[model samples]
Target chain A: SAVISQKPSRDICQRGTSLTIQCQVDSQVTMMFWYRQQPGQSLTLIATANQGSEATYESGFVIDKFPISRPNLTFSTLTVSNMSPEDSSIYLCSVGDRGSDTQYFGPGTRLTVL
Target chain B: DQQVKQNSPSLSVQEGRISILNCDYTNSMFDYFLWYKKYPAEGPTFLISISSIKDKNEDGRFTVFLNKSAKHLSLHIVPSQPGDSAVYFCAATPGVGNEKLTFGTGTRLTIIP
Candidate 1:
């Protein structure tokens, strides 16, 4: 079990603006992932943040809309570009520990784009 | 395509009774399954997991049953307690190193004391 934390626990932003959520882990991890949970919906994988490289987006998501940065093994960030009301959801960061198949999640950032 | 599905939206059980949560997956490629419990304003906590090779796995009062032939799995909590009340989510992964996971719509479990 890894201790994960995300900045901007909850926020409200105007449409067209972008909000960047930062994720930090207590220890180094090989893989970090970002997920989105819309209201009354299941969790959807947004992207896989790889250190020193570009992020891998899912089929329905794109890098332009959700750009990610992983500068080190213990830190990463996800920026919701050109936000809209539809983009309002809970964004979570997760880290996979060694020898464990489970991924530990952060408290999650609640973003509301008005 | 929803690879993982939780048909039930909610479930209620009396304290000290058994609570069962069901999940189904359309993808046969998935070999790893996990259950997570979540409370409001908090992140999900890992409960238990089962591998493809095993049909059942147990941890204390929680047991996970996997039926590969039916592409179905279930989590059973025996002697349920009030603290067990939370939203339970089922997730599946294709393999050990696979970073992608398909999650089912969570089922809110309520335990009545």
Candidate 2:
């Protein structure tokens, strides 16, 4: 299992503001992913971040709304742009091992937009 | 469409009993399944996973049983403890090696001592 950490454990922001969540891993990883969990809902994959390439976003999620930056193998950032009430959710980052399929997640950033 | 579905929203289990959480998927392309446990304010923790080629996979007290024909899978936790009380989510991916995962609505398990 990999050790992952995310900045801003919890935050309350005004609507229309933006927040950037950072994820750092202890060791180098090949794949990192961003996910969102809304109230009383399941987790939805936002995007996959790999170092030195553009992030691959799932359908219904766009880079404009959620921009991701993977500068290195152990660090990534996800910025929630133009936040709204619907954007209030837990943002989590996960790192997949180099050869293993199991992914370990960081303590998520809980964002509440009012 | 919701590709993965967990029918039960909550479950109450006595301590030392078995906790069974079920999940179903409509897509047959899903060849890998994983289970995660989430606490109130933390990220979901990966528990166990099973591949389509296998029918059962066990690790310690947690075991995952998959029935590909029915497109259904279940996680069984024997001798449930207080630490086992959390929201359990079942996720699926078409392949392995950190592919995009589709998650199901989690089932909250409460263990009564």
Best by lDDT: 2
State the displacement of the C-alpha of residue A19, model 2, in Å, after optimal TM-score superposition: 0.7
- Report clash pairs, candidate 1: none
Off by over 4 Å in 2: none
Per-prediction backbone clash count: 0, 0
**Would you estimate the TM-scores of all the predictions?**
0.98, 0.98
Mind giving the per-residue lDDT tens digits that candidate 1 earns over A1-114?
679999989999999999999999999998999999999888899999999999999999999999999999999999999999999999999889546788888999999999
Error of 1 at A39 (Å): 0.3
For each candidate, the alpha-carbon lDDT, in order, equals: 0.94, 0.95
Model 2 lDDT per residue over A1-114, tens place: 889999999999999889999999999998999999999999999999979998999999999999999999999999999999999999999999655878888999999999
